[model samples]
Target: MLKKELPLKHIKINYDPIIDTPLEIIAQYPDLYEQKIAENGIDTIIYDNDISDNVSFYNITYALNKDCMMFMNLPLEVARFSISNMTDYIIQLLEKSYYVQFLCDPYWVSNYVSYQKEHHEHPMLIYGFDTVNKYFLAQDYFDYKQKTKQLVSFKDIDASYYNSSFSQLPDEYQLLNACVLHCSKIVNTKAKEINCDLIKQSLINFLNCYSYTKVETEGIYYGIQFFDILINRYHNDSDYVSL
Candidate 1:
C-alpha cells in the first residue's frame, strides 16, 4: 500500500461562510497563501450579491489561479462520469497532489457531529491518503464539535460520498470540487515579491466602484459597492438577506 500526504490546514475566515472551506483550503499552500495575504487579504474586500438576496462573500476573489492548477465543481453524476468507486477516485487524486472536496454525509463519518445520528450534507475536504490504514486525512467544520483535522476511514468516505441523497440534490447542492496546488521549480535566484503595482490598481478599481464583469451573469454586484447594497438589502429585504 502506498501513502501520500499533502498539507491539510484550515483557517477561520470570519467574513464569509460561503467561501470558508475553499479559501481556507487555499491557505494551506505556502506560495498561494502568502500572495493571497499580500493582496487579497481581508482589508481588500468585495461583496457579492444576487437578486435572491443571498450575500455570498464579503472579501475579494483574486482568483490567483489556484497556483495555476485545477479546480472544478460539478454535479456528482457529472463528476463521476467514467470514474468508479468514490474512495478510489479520491485516492487517485490525492496521489496526484490534488485535494478533493465533496458534499459528504457526515452521518457516516466518525468524529463528525452527526455520525451515526442524522444525515446532513456539507462540504468535506480530503487532502491525504493512508492506503495502509484505509483512512483519508480530511478537514471538516462541524457546529457542535468545532472544526478539526480528522482521520476518516475509507469505508466512511465511500459511504458518505455515495449516499443516495447526494445524487438527488439540487444543482447548487450537488458538487464535487477538486483543486491542486501547482508546483514547479523556480528559475530566478532572487526572492519572490508581491506585485505592488497590481495591488494598487486593484484598490483603485474597488474605490472607483468597478464591478467584476467575470461573473456568470449580469447584475451580480462586487467590491466596496456591496456595502451599500448590503445596507439597503438589510433594510428593504431583511428576510431575504443571508450569508
Candidate 2:
C-alpha cells in the first residue's frame, strides 16, 4: 500500500486551468509567492486581433520556478505508451513530491457538467492518490465555477486520458499535454519586501489609461483602458451599443 499527496495551500481559479495548477502549486510557498506576486502580477497579450487576447494578473511566468514553484513538461505520448501501468506512473510522480496535470476529455470526468455527455477537452491536476481507495485526488472547477478537488476513479482518469485528442489544438500547444509541478530547492535568505513603488506606478498607469509596460506595442492592451476598448468594440457591433 502506497499513498502520496502534495501540499497545495491555495488555489486561484480566475484563469484557465492550464495556468491554474501552476499557481495552486506555487501558493504552497507563500514566502516566495506573496512578494513576487505584488511585483510582476499582470500581463496582457493580443497577438491575434479577433482572438488570443488575454489579460491576467497571475501569469504563468511568475508561477513557474522562476517566481515560486516549478514545472516541467511531460509529453502525453510518454505516459501513453512508455508506461505499462499509467496509474503506477502517476503514483510514482506523486511519491516524488510532484503534482501531475493532464489534458483530458471532460466527458469521462464525472464531476464536469459535460461528463458523459460531451467530449470536450480540458486540463485536470492530480495532487494525490489513494491506492487503497482506488481514486486520485484531482482538482477542477465544478459547474459552480470555483476551484474544487474531488476523488476521481483511476479507471475514469485512464479513460479520460485515452479519449483526449490533442491534435485538434494549435501547433503551439503540441506536446503540452501534461506537466510535473515541483517546488524550488534553493533557500531564500533575503527578506521578503513588497514592491510598493512598482505597484504604485502600475496603479498610476492603469488610472491614466496607459499601458503599464510604458512601451508602445500594437494590439496588446491592459488596465482600466481595457474597459473603454471593450466598450468601443461592442459599440461597433450594431448601429448603437446595446446595453
Candidate 3:
C-alpha cells in the first residue's frame, strides 16, 4: 500500500478579546480609525487554539483590506518562538527578492532594540548601526511616553497642533514631514480617486512655513529626489502600476 503525503498545514491565528476591545472604542473616531488601519492594518493574525475555534477567520480577512499587507501578532507566551520562526521565513523570502523595507511604527524598533540590548542574541539586530540622529529627533515623544505611560499617539490626534508645529521645524525635519505627506496623499487618493491638488497644496504650505530653517532647503531637495525616484519606479513597474 502506498502512503499518500498530506498537504502542508496552514498556521492558525487567534485574537485577544481583552486587548482588542480597545479597537472598538477607537473605531468611534472615524478619522483615527482610518489612520490606524492605514498605519497598522486591521487584519492582525493571532495564534491561540481557544479563540481560533470560535471566531470565523473570514472576519479577520475582511477587517484587513484585500490590498493591505498582513502581519502575525503573536501572544507574549509564544512571542519569542513565533518571532524567530517568522523572522527566519522572512529572511528566506527576502533572499529570493530584491529589496524589503520593514515599514513599521518606531515603537517596534525601540522594543526590538531594547530586547536585543538585553539578550544580545537578536537576529534582526544583525544590521545594527548608530540610530543616534533618529533617536535624538524622537526624544520628545519617547520622553512623553516614559512619563505619561501611554503609547505614542498618532499625529491625527492633534492634526492642527502638529500642522502648526511641523511648520516651524528645520529642513532636517523634512523627511518626517514627507512621511506625513505621503500618508495624506495615500488617504486622499484612496478615498476619492481624484486629483489631490488640495492635499498637495496643504503639504506645500506646511513645507513653505519652515523657510528659515537650513534643514528645510536640504530636506526639500532630498524629499523631491526621493519622491521622484519612488514615483518613477512605481509608475514604470507593471506590477506596481498604482500608488
Candidate 4:
C-alpha cells in the first residue's frame, strides 16, 4: 500500500506560535499562508505574543477554506475495521497525493509522557505511509524541542484508535474522522489576496459593535475596552494576573 511521500517541508516557524492544530496544517501551505497574512495585515503570525493588537483568530479558518482546499472527513468503524482495511484507506490517500490528518489519543503515539496512562485527543498529520517498512511519516508542530518531521509505527496508531474513549458530546468523537486534504486540487489556484483597507474597516466595525459585561464574576469581556481594563489591572493589582 506504500506509495510516495509529498515533497513538502517546513518553510517557516512562528515562534511561540499559537497552538491551533488547524493553523499548523495551514502553515505547510506557505504561499497561501503568505497571501492570508498579506491580505489581513497580519504582522505576526505567532498568536501568543500580540493577543491585544491583532485579530488572528478572527475568521481565520474561513479565510483558509476560501483560499484553496477542503478537508473531507473519512468514515471508519473503530471497533470493527480490520488493520488491512484501515491501512488500505491510508495508502489510497497517499497514492492520490493527499495528506491525511488523524485525530487520535496521544497516549499511544508518545512514550515521553505518562499520557499513555490517560486519554487525551490530539491531531497528527500523515504525509507518507510505508506498508513494507510498517511506519507512517508524520510531522508535529506541537513539539517544543524539535519542529522537524518524524516517523510513527502503524501498530501504535491502530491501537490508539481502537482504544479511544468517545467524548460526552456526540459531535466530539474520540477517534474523530480521518480527514483527507485535497491539496493537489489547489496546485494552480492562488489564495485570494487580502485588501488591507477592508480588514482595517472590519476591525473598526467590530470594535464599534463590541460589548460585554465587566463584572468579574461573569468572567468574560470583549474588544479593546476589555484590553485596557486588563492592562490596568495587570499594572495595578498583584492578583489580577496568574501564571
- Predicted structure 4: lDDT: 0.41
User: What lDDT, from 0 to 1, does candidate 2 have?
Assistant: 0.46
Worst lDDT 10-window in candidate 4: 180-189
TM-score of each: 0.47, 0.46, 0.21, 0.45
Error of 1 at 27 (Å): 21
Per-candidate total of colliding backbone pairs: 0, 0, 6, 1
lDDT digits (tens) for residues 158-221 of candidate 3: 2211222323335543222211110000011222221224323433443343332223332233
Ranking 1 against 2 by lDDT, winner: 2
Cα error, residue 24 of model 1, in Å, equals 12
| Candidate with more favorable, higher TM-score: 1 or 3 | 1
Per-residue lDDT of candidate 2, residues 1-243 (tens digit): 467776554221122222343333223234444544323333321121233222212233323322222233332332232344667777877775555665566677787887777554455667789998889988766563776789988888777655455554355433233222322111122422223344335434534542223335475344444434433443343121010
Residues 154-175 of candidate 4: C-alpha lDDT, one tens digit per residue: 7777766555444521353322
Tell me, what's the RMSD of every candidate?
Answer: 13.9, 14.6, 19.2, 13.2
Global lDDT of each candidate:
0.45, 0.46, 0.24, 0.41
Point out the higher-scoring one by TM-score: 2 or 3.
2
> In angstroms, how far off is 232's CA in candidate 4?
27
- RMSD (CA, Å), candidate 3 to true, equals 19.2
| lDDT score for candidate 3 against the true structure | 0.24
